[model samples]
Target: MNITEKILARASGRQRVSPDDVVFANVDKVMVHDVSGPGVIKVFDKLKKQGINVDKLWDPTKVWVAEDHFVPSADKVSAENIVKLSNFTKNYGIEKHFKYGMGQYGICHTLSHEEALVLPGEVYVGGDSHTNTTGALGSFACGLGHTDVAYVLLNGKIWFKVPQTLYFKLNGKLPDHVMAKDFILKIIGDITTEGGAYKAMQFGGSGINEMSVESRLTLCNMTTEAGAKNGIVEPDQKVVDYLSSRGATNISLIKGDDDAEYEKIYEYEGSEMEPLIAKPFSPENISIVREAPSVELNKSYIGSCTGAKYEDLVAAAKILKGRTVKIRTEILPASISIYKRAMEDGLLKIFLDAGVTVGPPTCGACCGAHMGVLAKDEICISTTNRNFPGRMGHVDSQTYLSSPLVAAASAVTGKITDPRDLK
Candidate 1:
């Protein structure tokens, strides 16, 4: 069995499981953000009104809630949604609620991993599609709809159809200017958007082993764009050390069996990869940074769970250290903790000195809810995930997706430029 299969099998109390096997597995944790929490609460209420008694969640400690999307209340509707989430969390006695502007708050995915709320070999679920981000820690995590979330909240279990696994074996050392974002973009370019539909993408080999936890998270986080059910990396010493630093103990590392069946296998040489850019409108429309059409930018943004990590910011700051951005630039740290660390390390100062506007830790602009919405005819070079039409603002606005390195370099030139050129 693959890692995903092993985790699901253990959770479902089965000795062995195969692809397409349906199982009602026990969940270790369930995460919900303000954007999706209200809908889940509504579903829970509707079920209760139908005479299904659910006075409390199956396990209050196991359910995590965070106010991220539309955070700081972008509008009246979003504010009302936060209110609903707050009321529900308080009334339900959920002790793990991270409210807006209170405590350690940030994007749910980043905060969850940083706080070690989810761990290896666990079966986890979140209301948002990027829940698969937690799979970087060796867990089997996936996204479900509000209805499925409500069911998990009430019963601590949810049904799942075992998915076929796709093996992505990454080898060779990465070039100095290449990053996990570039590698993932290369993979997406090869496989296309729907390539991994309903399958678990299991990453292995020396390249993944050499990557930091932040890189691994970014790698898994974007698999959702490829239509993957989940993206996972086998646990190693690096994972264990990260979890331990965050106070996680008793970690159980799970790996694929030697003869595990794979739906497909892809092998990539990290050293051969170059910085990649996903053109406007589709993540699969990728091109090498130097070869991509040279387009001017109105704004450059570096934020979101995918690109707002400490290492990502540091990389950007290194490029922007002695320069000023020709275009408007926004820098958002993934969480308050990350923000504080950046500040201490002078990364934030570097960004500010480069004429970059540093924003609070929120999913504000990434999802187009607030902070930095684009106007009509505007073009943005951003480090956020997704470049779908109207993703960051007006339907006519264009968003080109790239890594923080490329984003910072482009900001300095006000165009799609390569970071290596600056070097």
Candidate 2:
């Protein structure tokens, strides 16, 4: 069995086991966000009225509540929702409560790993679909609906059918203009939207070693788009170093056996993957752009839980170091801490000097209805998830999802150029 299998086995109370087995496992962590928490809270209230005891039911220390998304709320309804979420946190005594401007808050996925809220070999669940992002840290993390999250909060356990493992045995290197984002977008395109449903995608291969930690995180973060529980790459030195640097003192390393059995294996020569972009409505609808002439973007956004990372910052900085953005553009750090670190490293200066507006480390433009909202007939090239119709605010707005490098390059040229060409 591979690392995911091994971790699942241990969590399932088995010394060794295979895939698709239903099991009752303990949850090591639970998370909620303002966008999803109110829904979960309503369910919890109903369940409690039906005889579930909140204080006696679950571990308070294991649950986290973060207020992001419509932070400082763009409207009265959203502001009321945030207030309700805050009251629930205060009443329940949940140990981790993150307000919007605190150094600890960001997107649920980004803040989880940043604060070491998710740990290796643990079963973690969050309210948002992208909770699988925590799987990058060697945890068996997955997202759940509000009803399911409420049940877990009341029971500290949930049922899960083991998922078949899809092994991506990556090979080769990414093309000069292409980066990990393109690699993932191409994978999604090849597999289609529902390709990996009820599967555990275990990524490995020599090519993974060539990617930066942030790039690997981006790859795993979007696994939910394929309907996968989570995507994982076995813990390596990079994982250990990253955890250690984040003050994780007792991290456990999980790995697969040399002869581990996999449902399927895939080999990707990433070096052959061209700069790709996923057009709106479907992640698999991707194409290679050898030049930037195909797009006339009205806005370029370069941050999200998936796109806001240190390596992503460096990549965007490299492209915008001495240039100016033609269209309105915004760069958001994943967390306030990440923003401070960027400032310390002078990456923020590069972006500011380049005339790009840098927003706070929050889910600003990704939600679309808030900051950086689009105008009618506008197009945006963003580094976020799900490019559905009206996803970037205006119903008439079109979106092309790509890597931060592509976003930065597009910002500079006033069009979508391959980053390699700019070099």
Candidate 3:
């Protein structure tokens, strides 16, 4: 058994569990943002009509809320949903609500790490697909739909059929020009979007260990595009320090056993990895950034749970310093903490000097909800994870997904260009 099995086995209070074993594991933490919060409320309302005891939760302190999607409300309906979500949380006695315009608000997944809300060795679930992002902390983190989240809220438990694991071994440190985003894009391209369906994608090896916790978070965040049940990296010293710096206590690092079993093992040489991109319509449609076809890009977005971390901003700023963008560019830090760090570190100045717009932290436009969505026929190079049609705006709009470095470089050229090809 591997780390995943061990976690689930212990969670279910069993001596041993294997793949396909269904167990109602006690949940450690659960979350719902403004979008899913409202959906969960609707489920609660429906349950009330069914005469269930929807008045109380199993554990209010274990439940947290985020106001990310459609925040800085785009329309009357969105505004109303935010209000409804607020009331629901207040009524439920949930205390960790990160609201928009509040000092610490940000994307839900970003908050999961920046605030150390989800600790290692815990089973954490959220109402967004990208909730898998928290798995980088070595937790059995995954996403649940509205009804599923509501169940966890009331019962403090949810059943899952243990998933088979796929191990990705990254050897050595990646080149400075390459990033975890590029490595993940390459893996998704090789496996295709449905390749990891219903399986856990676990990363390991020297390269993964060498990567920063934020970089590992980037890797896990994009695993949703590969149709993975979840993505994870065994927690280590880096994970401990990251969480501790954010004020997390009782941190524990969990690792797979030396005899851990995996369905398949894929290996990659870090030096061979290059800047990669996923063209529009699907995340599996990938290509080397330098070999990309010529296309007129109307915008470049350096925001989202996938890319707007502080390290990502540093990468983009490194490219944009003393240079201006040829296309409209926007940089939204994943959280207010990241935003403040960029400001203090002068990364914000570099972006502003490069003529980029720095907006407040939100999941804006990443899910095509609001704030700088694309127009018809508009093309964009973004640091986001997905590239499906209409993902960032009009149904006809196209998106190219890349690392922050590639996106920043393309912003300076108005087309797909590698960071090394710039200047």
Best candidate (score: TM-score)? 3
Output the better candidate (1/2) by TM-score. 1
Off by over 4 Å in 1: none
Q: TM-score, each model?
A: 0.98, 0.96, 0.99
Tens-digit per-residue lDDT, 268-292, candidate 3 = 9999999999998899999998789
Q: Rank all candidate structures by their lDDT, best first, as comma-separated numbers.
A: 3, 1, 2
Instruction: Judge candidate 3 against the unseen true structure and give its global Cα lDDT, from 0 to 1.
Output: 0.93
lDDT tens readout by residue for model 2, 1-423: 787778777876888777878877778889999878999878877877988766543888899988778875878998999889888888888768888755577778888877877777888999988888878787888999999998888888888888888888678667666778888887888887798898988777888877666777888888887788788888777877887888888888888889888888878886678887888766777878664347678888998888878778888998998888888889998887788889999999999988889987667768785878777789999888778888878888888888999899989887877887784
C-alpha root-mean-square deviation, candidate 3? 0.7
Best by lDDT: 3
Residue 275's lDDT in candidate 1: 91
Question: Least accurate stretch of 10 residues (summed lDDT) in model 1?
Answer: 95-104
Q: How much is 290 displaced in model 1, in angstroms?
A: 0.5
Q: Extract clashing residue pairs from model 1.
A: none
Error of 3 at 105 (Å): 0.5
Clashing pairs for predicted structure model 2, backbone only: 173-270, 173-271, 189-284, 292-416, 292-417
Off by over 4 Å in 2: 291-293
The 10 consecutive residues of candidate 3 with the worst lDDT sum are 250-259
